[model samples]
Target: MPGLLALVGGDEFKPGNEEQDRLMVAAAGAGPAYVVPTAAARQGPDQAVAHATEWFAGLGLALRELPVLRRSDAMKASLADEAGRGGFFYLSGGDPGLVAQVLRDSPVWRAMFGAWRAGAVLAGSSAGSMALCSHTLVRATWPNRFRRRAMEALGAVPHTAVLPHYDTFGHKWVESAREAAPDLTLLGIDERSAAVWHDGRWRAAGPGAITVAKGAKMTRFESGAEVKGLRQPARMLPGR
Candidate 1:
């Protein structure tokens, strides 16, 4: 069996979300739970790791911080080898576009994929979550020409775009995204919440909820509720 996959909305490593992290730690087992801060490269990756370090410690799990801050670092053989030591791996928050750009087809990502296939828990929060999917919405930055758009991703979880931090301002961003591409499925996940894959079904984890809307019909799943009929994404199992 492939291990757990957590797609956290935003506000990762925060206190209220311990319910999901506890499950991750339990599933992770003895090996180190590596934290890859690649997405936070421009936004103080070290500080994010430090924050995560304190948070995971409280959960009694020590994290191996993988400092793959740039695309160059993602290709390193040394880091790739080190990544295999992880029983659980987390891709923290930052730029969705950069995370996908850096890690896709890289040696370190291959190792991480191998680990996840061997039953290691692979979790990603916010930008990390978006990059894990087949397509993701890139947040506006840089210049007027570089506002935002849907970009292709790694496809660990296929065929969807996530709107993180949904309970608040994240919902506001979705309108522009929906208008830009009306066909795409937007999974609006609330902050401090996560959509988790387990036991052949999707579960609404943590304090907040997961919302899926189709036309005028909107559906919401509260915490611990089973998300019925939600499209199940491909897993990193041993065989297809």
Candidate 2:
């Protein structure tokens, strides 16, 4: 079986979201859980690690931090070994563009994909989720003044882009994302919610809902709802 993939919206490591965390843990089987705080490194890894530690401790699981902060760290053989060993690997929230820029084509990223292909559960929250898609929405920096741009991502789930925090600020980017990549499926994931891939399709998990936007149509799938054929229309396009 392929490893379970969890793309969380945000607000992970909280009480109400324990069920989702537990699900990932259960999917991990016997290997240890590893938390990749690379995205949160700019904000401070210490705080991110601390948060993950507390959350995992609550579930009686030891949290191993993968310190792949910079591009240099992402290329280390030791970090790749640790990443490959994880039964469940999680990438926390932060700047999605930063995450992609640092980890793209890195040894650690290759190891992570290898581990996931080998049946290790993989989860990404907020920006982490964005980075996992084929095209990621980059929030504008101070100089850019709030512009959103679609950029290349990991392509773990190709032709898809995730808009985290959809219930709040994420909704604003929906139109821009559509205009940027009309053929791509844009998922608006609410906070504390997740879209998990299993049984050959993507299914909603957690408290909030998921919105699937393709061209001019937008469909909302509640928790536990099945999101099927999301890529069909795109595949039918002239140049897919």
Candidate 3:
């Protein structure tokens, strides 16, 4: 049994994200929740974990912090075993490249993946979301804030990429994202919002909307709505 999958825009552990987190809680059952603050290693992982624990506590989930801040931490068999026991696992925001580099082929990631494959909910916010896909847009190493380079990711969701914080800085990367992975499905999720995968379709959640960018047009889907494109090579919808 596969569990829920969510890619949230930036601003995790904030006021606006409660709605979506609540949804995760309902589907999560009684198993423990784990927050992987690996991405926030340089940005203060302890603080990130604290925030996650506090936020999820309000949601009735006493979240455990999987503080695997380095490659060494990721390789520890004990840490990997702990990662495999969670009913819900969250990857919080920070430097996406660091997250990928440390956890890409590590034991912790493998254990976490097994848990997810066995029906544990998996969600990532901001850079965490970006790194869950097949390819991630790398920005930390570059001097220019707006410029990004494509790099390998965990590939939990194949042929897909997310632009978190769309209402803020994410929209600026639209063209760059397209150039990086033209064949991939491009999703622009607004801050505080999320696109969750249940079954084979994606559903929009939270206070904001989700945008699926295609060619010269962008379509928006409000919360509770399923985001889908018209079937190709078929009867067109008016001029579309």
Q: Which candidate is the best by TM-score?
A: 2
Candidates' C-alpha lDDT: 0.81, 0.81, 0.81
Error of 3 at 237 (Å): 36
Q: Which stretches of candidate 3 lie over 4 Å from their true place?
A: 140-142, 229-240
> What C-alpha lDDT does candidate 2 achieve relative to the native structure?
0.81
| CA RMSD of all predictions | 2.8, 3.8, 6.4
Estimate the TM-score for candidate 2: 0.91
Model 3 residue 59 CA deviation (Å) reads 0.9
Q: Could you tell me every candidate's TM-score relative to the true structure?
A: 0.90, 0.91, 0.91
- For each predicted model, how many residue pairs clash, with residues at least 3 apart or on different chains? 0, 0, 0
Which is the better candidate, 1 or 2, if ranked by TM-score?
2
In model 1, the runs with Cα more than 4 Å from the true position are 140-148, 214-216, 235-240
RMSD of candidate 3 to the true fold? 6.4
TM-score of 1: 0.90
Ranking by TM-score: 2, 3, 1
Clashing pairs in 1: none
lDDT string for model 3 (70-117, tens) is 999999999998888878999999997888898888888877777777
Model 3: lDDT of residue 132: 81
